[model samples]
Target: MQRKIYITIILFLGIVMNAQSGKVGIKTANPKETLDVNGVTYTNSLYLRNPGEPTMTGGSFLATSENALQLYDPNLESSGLFNYLKLSLTGISGAGVTDYDTKIDADKFLIVVHNYSFKMNDGTTNVALDYGDNGTNDNRQGSPDVVAFKSKGTWHIRARFTDSKLIALTSANPGRTYNNFTIDLYLMAYKRLITKQNINDITSDLGGTNGSSKTVNRPSGF
Candidate 1:
């Protein structure tokens, strides 16, 4: 009988595999971690994709201009609350019921104006009234939060804390006269997502028997 000797060897390129945990390591001789990258690893770009994920479209490293990023939740409805925060400044005649929906999450939307000077209706145009530019912002005798000064004079309104409805600019006196400058507001309609059905349910849960005349609407024919 003749005896033969053979030499065989297996090698890995600085990589380790854990079959139990399904983990891989790089540049590590004895890899005890999933992905063990020793030194600085550079990459030009990166991408994220979910083949069967729900609601999440994807992600990318390179930025785009138009509609590049999107997030969607199936629960949100088209009629749900939406808002535009960039509000237009108009003369608020006191806290009158201007022309808009005021009941938003107990007035979640707030109003503020730029401190930039404006052409007041009055002949003398004053510099924009800012926080530091006190004594001039209001006629309330140095009241901090007051926005208006004279009732009919030119008052350049600066920034204000977010409060009140989009259209209704609440003043100390709701009946005061506001002149010049048509204001528009940036709507923030999504502070709370409410549906028509939710309103009905609330009414019924509170008082109505739900199936009685209280909850039901009577038609014109009736």
Candidate 2:
């Protein structure tokens, strides 16, 4: 029994001496960190917090102050939510409009026209679209000029003609019917309320001294 007690004291001294070197390893001979464990670890809860921070409990969560991680906070409105959609604008005629059900709230979303493609059902085939011409050339119909807006949870798209009457006189299809017109829209929807007019009216001046920072409230959406 005395020999066994001497062995336990020596083992405890060995562990203390190892820890005094600034790093202690569990199930490992050489440790690279303060508390390196070579084997698996189990714990009921894990938390990360700043030094001297108080422990949190009762449904509380850990959050970081890092800017890269703080850029997106799920607690705020989902302003970063993005959606892509393809819209078929069929039978675009002079002063004609097409309506589509977006299913996204009109007051809480923003839309941007990403790209467009046009097709002709008439005899004309393989006609390249001229993006620079805005209906000024009589020989060519030019790219379709249109305006898109959301109203009452629906998207309203309308065709704008520089001079529909003039194009009708020179176009092969005098009826001014543009068949198979399509557009790709990029939608950014937010769960909170935001208006198109409010975003449009914003003109923030971010110019200032270098490395200067300011604290401000989160935007309406985020």
Candidate 3:
């Protein structure tokens, strides 16, 4: 019994010392990470309670102080939503602007908030102060088309003005040099990784009875 106990202590010490330097692997001879596993994965509620992990229970997550959402928070009429994408459309002119498309990963949701628009040039001189070319006749539609949303996991935008402006501007100037513009739009794409329970928590916490899709009145500049 004394010899057996001595051998067990020797074995335990050997294992403890060896494990200090060796990476641990499950079903693997060599592990690339500190703790590596092979094949399928399974978890339970208790698994999420690991130390230093973010709370599994979600409600009004406050971002870090340097987060951009905090900066824009004051500008929004209704307080909610987080930034997912910051997209810019700049220095566009003469029609035929290539479409813009961004595809996010699976199970993600995208929301847009159009903010501001600006012009680099006034597009030709003097009497340009006219509003007669507003898609009425499809004669002078020189502006870009409205933003388009499609679900191949992408958000798409095409630059084309009202049909009337297309006709009038193309016919009159041909080059359409008088319509250079730029715009800033915000994309609020929620991460797919957000827990469903947290999502429900948002609905309950915010008192937002309107459901997921809230109507946004787009400014004319965009």
TM-score of each: 0.23, 0.36, 0.35
The CA lDDT of each predicted structure is 0.33, 0.48, 0.45
lDDT of 2 at 108: 51
By how many angstroms RMSD does model 2 differ from the true structure?
A: 12.0
Candidate 2 yields a Cα-based lDDT of 0.48
Model 3 weakest lDDT span, ten residues long: 123-132
Ranking the candidates on TM-score from highest down gives 2, 3, 1
Per-residue lDDT tens digits of candidate 3, residues 27-142?
Answer: 55555555556555454433323332243443233322332222223354233344556666656553424466666433454445454333333432221211244423332323
Over 100-198, each residue of candidate 1 has an lDDT whose tens digit, in order, gives: 433333323222332322233332332132223232334222222324221222222332322221111233322223354333333343433222221
Q: Which stretches of model 1 miss by more than 4 angstroms?
A: 1-82, 93-178, 181-187, 193-222
Q: How close is candidate 3 to the true structure, as a TM-score?
A: 0.35
Model number with the top lDDT? 2
Model 2 TM-score relative to the real fold: 0.36
Report the lDDT of model 3 for residue 204: 30
